[model samples]
Target chain A: MSVATADGLTLAGRDRRFGLLLTAPGLLSLLIVITFPLFFTLYTSVHDYTLLTPNYDTFVGTENYQEALDEEYLPGSLWVTTKFVLASIVIEFIIGFAVALSLHATRRFGSIYYLILLAPLLINPVVVGLLWRMLLHSELGIVNYTIGLVGISPVSWLGDADVAFWTVVLTDIWHQVSFMAILLVAGLAALPREPYEAARMDGASTIRCFIHITLPLMRPVIAVAILLRLIFAIKTFDIIFIMTKGGPGTATDLISYYIYRAAFFGLDVGRASAMAAGLLVIILALTAYLYRYMNSLK
Target chain B: MRLFLSVVAALALAVSAAQAQTIRILMETVPDTRYIQELLPQFEAETGIEVEIEAISYIDMHSKLVPQLIAPEGSYDLIVVDFYWVGEFTKAGWLMPLDDLVERDGVDVDVYVPKLMDLVGRVNGVLYMLPFYNYSMALIYRQDLLDDADEQAAFQEAYGMELRVPQTWDEYWKQVEFFTRDTDGDGNRDLYGTVIQGQRGDCISMQWANYLYSQGGLYHDENWNPLLDSPEAIRAMEYYREAVEKYSPAGSEAYCFDEAFNVMAQGRAYSFVTFNILYAGFEDPESSEVAGKVGITPNPGGGLNGGWGWAIPNSSPNKEAAWTFMKWAESAAVAKERAMLGGAPTQAQIFTDSDVVAARPYYPILGEILAGTKDFPVFTYTTEFVEQVGLELNLAATGEKPVAEAMAAAQEKLHALLVKDGKIEE
Candidate 1:
């Protein structure tokens, strides 16, 4: 018995070592690509560096961060980003849930409907932006033209500061809502029908059944969907870049776009790095809150 | 054994002979790219240097070039530097000075138009680039509309002056107002008087500068003090807003050069003030609805001297090969060839060349505009200044803020930026 136990212990230790050996390459790669950039950005945030004049690097600890705090556009852009993320995610979720419910209820031609809904998700975001830009053009677009037939005057969708923000949000939803719908549809399909059936048999209405049985069970899936969309929507750059370019007097200039303008257009690397660090902190805090909420749901 | 060895030696020699010197060029996706691509085969035949080209949209060119330039070794051997970037590029020491190469090769730098050379080639008395193409703003209008006998009579009656191509800002605005009326009496308005490049960031800034400079307003005095909040600057901004609001298309607030030029070329707008390179697009029958009806004039206010030049990056390993390519591309013969192939001519002689003049009748007018074109401030902080001013101008044009308020804000922002850059005292 003692000899057997020693052999088993040796086998278990060897297995653990082999598993670590297999994961070592992936871990090193992640450190090089992700961890290194994160630390470098943190380091750069403290230095007075400009890409144009690289020879003038000097250690100016916290000056960049202090300057960013004073910049009018930084806070404005952060607020814009927060508003856009919350508004887009909520709207996308509601509309996506509705579409998923509709698709799930349909028994005939459901696959065709599902495929059609998935088409927008497959399109490149930049292309979607350009497509929407043409479609929403005040004078030339078919969207305005079609609406004009119903006695609507031409509306400056992208040119008006009042409307440009919502236009961008709507365009984003149009492009990404399909993704949310697909995720929710899969979640709806995987749900155990027993509880819903029992609720229905007990004279519960469709809405009540959904609220008490379906939603409670789908909480984990919804949480995952929301978290994923939040992560992507916070870093939204391509669509805003292609469509409005954060224009109409910075109505839709989200934090990411502001950071890009600072880094690339302004060439103020230190300030841009500081802005990037600020964004990293915001994302980390939101992710932590989301992870806890998701765990609670589970 | 000897025969086999000789065959092997011959193969080695052939391989070495076929290994031609190659250079990579990064440039904007303008008509110049097409011209260069068509001219490359001949250049390769004459000199066995293979050229690889990467052309991107104008908006992306600067961002792409800056990163490559900042890298330890740049990816591009030759880069096309926009006029506004000359100061920044030179200040950063990213460009290789071409004086030695020009002296060694006896390249006649005098052949390029003097104003263009001044605008793009030189910074602080040092030549770091060679002017490749000119994009000076020119007044493009409908010759047919200008020559309309009844319209001219009505215009004279209404404005108490004979209607012709405007030579000043007040007359330009007057003409814009006169031409803004409906021509067809069909209740629906199809044509606008003019189009403004009012897109928020870059276009409006350049468009407004023409008016500002025409009113004798300089961005800075000799001491680099902020002069953007002066009365003349406010008047310029106000005039720009008036033109866009009163005479431009419904969506003119979002119009950039491409949209403004399209409105003119499609015969929906009576006139447009934009870059000279757009002449090719306006003349292309396939793309333009008013191909032969177009006329070109010197921009009423001094035209904006916007163009690009070819520079060898200091990090480029193939400096010699790149220099050779630049010289060949800028040669008078090649310049004329490119001009005939729809490229804007940088060489003064190309404007006078019979074939080029015949192909583009306004070549002389272009030459005149190039001679008198005014450039944006060429300073290290010029990009930041342009961006801030552009944002404010866009706000003013969109009616988000009043012209005076926007100009005041722009002035304050630019002053702070300059102080931070150590260009001015606190």
Candidate 2:
């Protein structure tokens, strides 16, 4: 009886086949565009194929990987990237949290306030870079002029390594906080109001209520936001590049910019692919950890 | 109903019969669409073709073009590449040689300025791209400030010459110091000695290469070995660093071409070194504070050499059309038009055009400069070498490392690269 039933076509099997057919187009598109290119890049990492000399390509297995690990350029750029990502995400999270709390406190004009807070995120990154560059010009820009009025000497926002790095982080935070704030606002809104009300009835202080109730409830959302922002921040190229091009030194040269310089300017495709592979592994590992942590919160 | 629908479909097909060919050209300079505004209509009428001109900032355009060329895809029919990029473009086979087009079309390449033409057109005895516009760096200053200082006689006494316009590096710096003072006595220093680019990128390389070339330095020696750490090259690098530290803006290390231009034009900086392309902006009264007051001279030399020429890409699909456009664009008539529009023309004759000379008195001297301008070595790795040296120079300027040590390090890196590329024997 079991053999006869197995040999016959069943409704559940037909339904599964239909579902697979429906999803094939989407899956194929992903394979062609994303999955194929990703695997190709991984393969290229172990080969020597400078774009200029495509004919002279060869499989120099693991050499490119070893070279990237030992190269001073890669290490210097990685250090800059770590500092940029850590600083940008930490500041954005703090500011975004504060903004979220304030918005939650306000009942009137909440929608309008949110719309205004989200304005920085709406602007294009390159345009933001150009606009901020103009504002920060030492002689002709208004930023320096405003500081001058306060009796502070004009500061070079983009001309010094230390200052330029902070300025880039500041600009990244300015854009990212808006996004994080919106996420935090959702997290705050989703939270049960009864806990705060009960805590109020018990004569618990507002700070105590926040620390005990609000913070714990918002943890998962905060983790997701940080994880997403951290990954995006690590690959920052457009704004920092437009603003400084990793200038004054290699201070703002992130991993993405380094990979670009290696492939395009340095004309070393194999090394760039290897560097990119390094970034991919790190991001995937971190993402996995974050996902697990978020699931644990539930 | 079927017969009526068939008739309607036939009419739609007829309407769509007029073929419209699309052509895209990428350009870095934001030319007023009006210059070619009339020409497009005539071309479209004759050929039934549509033209799309996508103008991008110079840095952005080059960055985009580099990746596209590596793939050798014909995304653009015409592209404007710089003189330095010609080597990389040709050697990589991203560009198509145009000697056949020139011979078949009877193009008078001789009509273009000889040096500009040679720099852009030739690569290993083959014609790659045609030169478009030519530009050279110049010393721009405020004449009224110089006149008021009355330090011409003082300069003559010290240097045994009258300081009409600085002709040497030493005199130029001295003038920057002399004029950079508080004239209003308002406790606030309203003026600076000079402002020049110090950024560790293309702008710094562009400005500093002139000085490097002037000091008898070469990117590659006769043996094709990268000589970025040579004595002459180090001296040139030292000169640029000292100038920035002594006279330029406080955060001069990040200055680019635009910053240097704004400094002199806004009256914050007494003098600046900038490209002749900025003359139009410097001359506009609405845009500049020192419009009529700005004066220009040949960039003071440690010896004498500097400037840029345009080039065509080897990957151009429309070689014939490109060559035709280039020749027409650089012709005497067009050069005169370009001059009147405040563009620097390549021709020597255009400088002497009465209208051009009257509007821009420095046009004549600019011709002399362009005539004498030397080309940076044509190598596939020119950009990388410049970038490395620029980084090292910036490090030295910021006092992060000793100049000799930084130069030596850059030299070692570049040597390894050259040796690896097989441009130089190990």
Candidate 3:
């Protein structure tokens, strides 16, 4: 069944063998890093795996998932997580797109501007949280003191629950808006000049051109950028950990941190794993929905 | 020539293998760990065993250490266990009892403060660790302010009482309201009465535990039923809330130990309830603006007994080596040396050392504090309990939840957990 070619080797079989050999390392690494851990989490989710007594002997199928669902704080954590993710993503996207448009129109030293815009993103999230915590301290921080000097009252940045959630969201936006801006700017730069030229020749307004040409053409890039931010936003941990710690009565209790509390503080690794797996499912579903919607737009 | 080379290479290999057999310790980021780091060279010179330390903050230590302990062959040979966690780890079989090792080695356990030893040395009659240092809580006040004649007169006029160390919760509150005022007449209230550790988790839990105790709140009954919803417990939580909302600094509702200590150390606040180990940090002229003027005493009603201990994990490969390090570190000479370096003195005898006393005048007060100090409740779910209770306290402090509702909710949840753990009936 082999078709022989040069040097007494079958062309199709030899080509296929070489291709497999070339891609083996990549596939193997993918399996090891991603596939194995995913399956392990699923497996652990079904068992009574606790850090206290880590073993697989106890097979409590779906018990962990049921308990996690039944837990009182689970709803609150999910609600907070949804709010934080939405606020961070929506605000970041709007600001990022605006900055990206401004940068695209810039005629000067663009790299200096990029360096300025990327400064917060360049800092580690941990450092960002700490820097903001100090800067926003109600009594001692420069922010409150400066504001106070101008007759504004001190704002409890991380103390009051309503204020705390928004404070965290703003801090996140400050750290992450740059990412979206840079990504959108790249998308804007890569857009075709031909369509815009056509629109200009047609005497279309800039806003009309932007709506008709830019939005339709840049849809994929926007989709990808927003999707990535959505995924990252859902898993946000460092800011909450360093700043609010899911506190002021579970006001900022993101699901990720709640799972962490379950695993570490509660010592219930199985329940945490189930929660993680559920989050993974939710993320996948959201991604699929977004992808379908993007395709529909096209 | 080849034979001669073989003999030399074999000897080198053996020596290198011996040298590689070293012990590692996991510790909390505290001054005692710093003391150990400085003395590592001496320990190595004496025992010919190299040592390594990985220290982290209290918030991260539990999660980081637990994973390692789960491994059959642990990465660390020695670990510093906070007493609250000793019971949990021991029950899980993650730690090895050291009674036989202590007896065989003739280690003098009596050298340590008995209260500390009782707190961390054993779990259900099995000796699991050696005391490292004491962190028994104390109330630190500005001694200079108390002694000022003008301030006394002002205080007398304001409250019709002599200014002295607060002896009751009522006294503490009155002092808080009276002392918290504009210090420099800038219209911004500069001086607070005291500072609070009202941050989300461990900080608030550890701080409020003292208040809860003094006001007759217990974490649970003997039958493991949560008693947090009782009247006394609610009162205690209300008092803590008032301290944050009405009397303390503008942002005292969200503070960790460092923030509280800094407020007191900068002389912006008049008093702070904190670990006894902080006396040195307060007295350090470089760190504290009020150095040599701060005074320590037992909190108005009670203090919390707390500290860490050194233990070898069951999974550690270097058990004997770890024990050797413990013995060396806890030895009379080494302990005294650590005390001299402003380490929290765990050994009873070090408190009486004239030189040590001269260096740390607050040790006697700590000794008195120790007399009535109580350890935070220990049970199968101590860490979780603290976190849950701490969250409630923070919520009540911030006025996010009514104190009674928060306590009731905490009790309800904890009762459910106790039932799940089989500690109580449904």
Model 1 residue pairs with clashes: none
**Candidate 3 CAPRI-style tier:** medium
Estimated TM-score for each candidate: 0.95, 0.91, 0.96
Q: Write the per-residue lDDT of candidate 1 for residues B26-69, one digit (tens) a residue.
A: 98777888889888998888888888999898778878888888
Better of 1 and 2 by TM-score: 1
Top model by DockQ, which number?
Answer: 3
Residue B86 in candidate 1 has what lDDT?
84
Model 2 segments more than 4 A misplaced: A1-23, A55-57, B1-22, B30-50, B67-73, B149-161, B184-188, B214-216, B302-319, B353-359
Per residue, candidate 2 scores C-alpha lDDT tens digits across A1-298 of 2222354757676677789999999999999999999999998888897867764358999999998898766788888899888898989889999999999899799889988988889999999988888888877789999988988888978777889889989988877788999899899999998999999999999899989999999999999899989889988999867888788778777889878878877777888898899899999999999999999988
Give the best candidate by TM-score: 3
Question: Residue-wise lDDT of candidate 3 within A172-196, one digit each (tens)?
Answer: 9999999999999999999989998
Which wins on TM-score, candidate 1 or candidate 3? 3
Order the candidates by TM-score, highest first — what do you get? 3, 1, 2
Give the alpha carbon lDDT tens digit for every residue of A4-93 in model 1. 345565666777778999999999999999999999898888988887776446899999999889987677778888899999999999
| Residue pairs in clash, model 3 | none
The superposed Cα distance between candidate 2 and the true structure at residue B115, in angstroms, equals 2.1
